[model samples]
Target: MKFLEENLLDHLQRPEFAELHSVLINHKFSKGSYICQPGMGSNQVFIVVSGRVRVYLGCEEKEFNLGILTKGDIYSTHTGTFVQALTDAVVLMTDVKTFRQRMVGDPEVTKAMVRVLGNILKTSFTIIDGLAFKDVNSRLVALLSNEARRHGMSLEDGSVQIQIDLSVEQIARLVGSTRQTVSMLLSDLVRAGLIERPERGKFLIPNLSALESVGGVTLS
Candidate 1:
């Protein structure tokens, strides 16, 4: 997934950024590996070079997913959250002290940090709104619509085709619903002509308007 057009390295955009390459130690983790845990001594931040990771709260039985970080996403190792690799992944790890030192007197660095924090806060709010007010179906639609807007291709016929490779359980976990419920809802969407499963995992959204309608979204 093209999660980033420009990353932290690009944000700096200076000759000094070349120094990051030397400091960035590449690390590989298998799926299900714990990257970090709450209260663990974490003194570094991570930049995902490839693969996916999930930052969440709670334990194994019930997890409230805060966000999913794919390629180019950043996460602090010191966060009071459990981070696990959702897929076999490679990440760039650098000392937090060094990273901050590099940014010590640069206004651009502060702006970049603000931008990243702003996005995180926005995502947190969206999650809160969905959980507090939206029903399961609406939440699922919003989830799919968000993903579609990010990674889907728009066709000449006004349809959007997105490659969703996540499993039913994974999708359920993301929307804070049961697997059975999400599966039934997905079937309903197929029958309603709003979505089509062209392959096992991929989806084609025939009409974005229909999706928005079902999701109870009104665009001005």
Candidate 2:
């Protein structure tokens, strides 16, 4: 049998997922709305059908972004992370118990769930590693480099433009620094000819290799 697809959107077209699909409840969230907050007793699994959601952890004083889920990504709400819409969004969701039951009956689906959980674990470890080993500037550079690889559009002039869709404050949260610090670092980058801001919520890397060099980490 074919292994289940990673994208939940693809699963919607598969006969094997029909039962689970039938039970999915559709919900919409406006930008900055919380889909799941800590200690909310959330027990649902959700798939992002449209727009972007931010998974993060923190108290009122500080926050750390765990990951951003765009269309086709899946997550379980019971993971205790705060899930908030970064943009106006729609999601299809079902109770965790129902999803577990389906996984128990379907080996392929179980495999897919395992892969999803594995990715989540890997991301956690990466964050931990960055916190323990990297300084603030290094962490920010790594974040930008990774985002470029994942979401950038190449230009004819050998530059890569990333629609990062995050304010400097949000980026500071992701890199565990103050917004003023991040802003200064960004200015330094611009002066060093590493990056440019052509518009709000976007970044242009004139030389991705040079930017990656400053972080001293290999891009996989």
Candidate 3:
């Protein structure tokens, strides 16, 4: 059993989750895999150790992107979102039954609960703001700039390689927008000479400083 002995595990010392230290499952998944069906989550919490996963919500066989889980993150709240593997990944899984039982029986689980709840609330608020405040183009730009800012690797000729192979449609779902809007945003970026698409669905950032400035990350 892979143990969570890191800072997050300190929550187990709480009276709420002290007894939850046992009986959890660990597993791995390859790229293009489904971790759980949308709206069919069974109270399981997944801790991602490597790679990325996409969360989506659905109704009547239609699902949309909720968010992406990167390395060293956790996903427990269902909230109508089903977790899907975006890349080859590994995860630690524990269900809602163990969660409730552990919350009272294990101190660490209790503490972890508080942290996780705070994170969930924070993300919820951010999503609300993104939906209410930004236009579709701005939203897509912000999302791409943020993702590239974090995950991009600098190339030799001032270009940065971002590994995600997202088409405009995927990006539209990501920012809670439409494909036409995202296509316009991409076209704008392309015209500005800020992004280079050497291959279909792959975006290479040619100038980090300018992109960062537009991204509101002051180049310091």
Best by TM-score: 2
For residue 79, model 1's alpha carbon misses the true position, in angstroms, by 1.6
Candidate 3 stretches greater than 4 Å from native: 1-22, 58-66, 99-117, 154-160, 212-220
lDDT of 2 at 178: 92
Candidate achieving higher lDDT, 2 or 3: 2
**Residue range 1-220, candidate 1, lDDT tens digits:** 2334456656544676666556778999998898999888988877888877877676566556666677767767886778888789899888899877665666755565565556657667787888899999998888778767766889999999976556788778878889999999999999999999998658999998789888996432
Candidate 2 residue lDDT tens string, 5-45 = 45667856688778778888899999889999989997998
Per-residue lDDT value at 65 in model 2: 68
Q: 1 or 2: which has the higher lDDT?
A: 2
Give me the overall lDDT of model 3: 0.63
Count of clashes in candidate 3: 16
lDDT per residue (tens digit) for residues 1-220 in model 3 = 0112244534434454445546446789998887887456466776676777876565554344445666545567465566677778887678877666655644544565455556446545655676798666656656666556655677888788776656667667767767897788788878898887788757888886686556454311
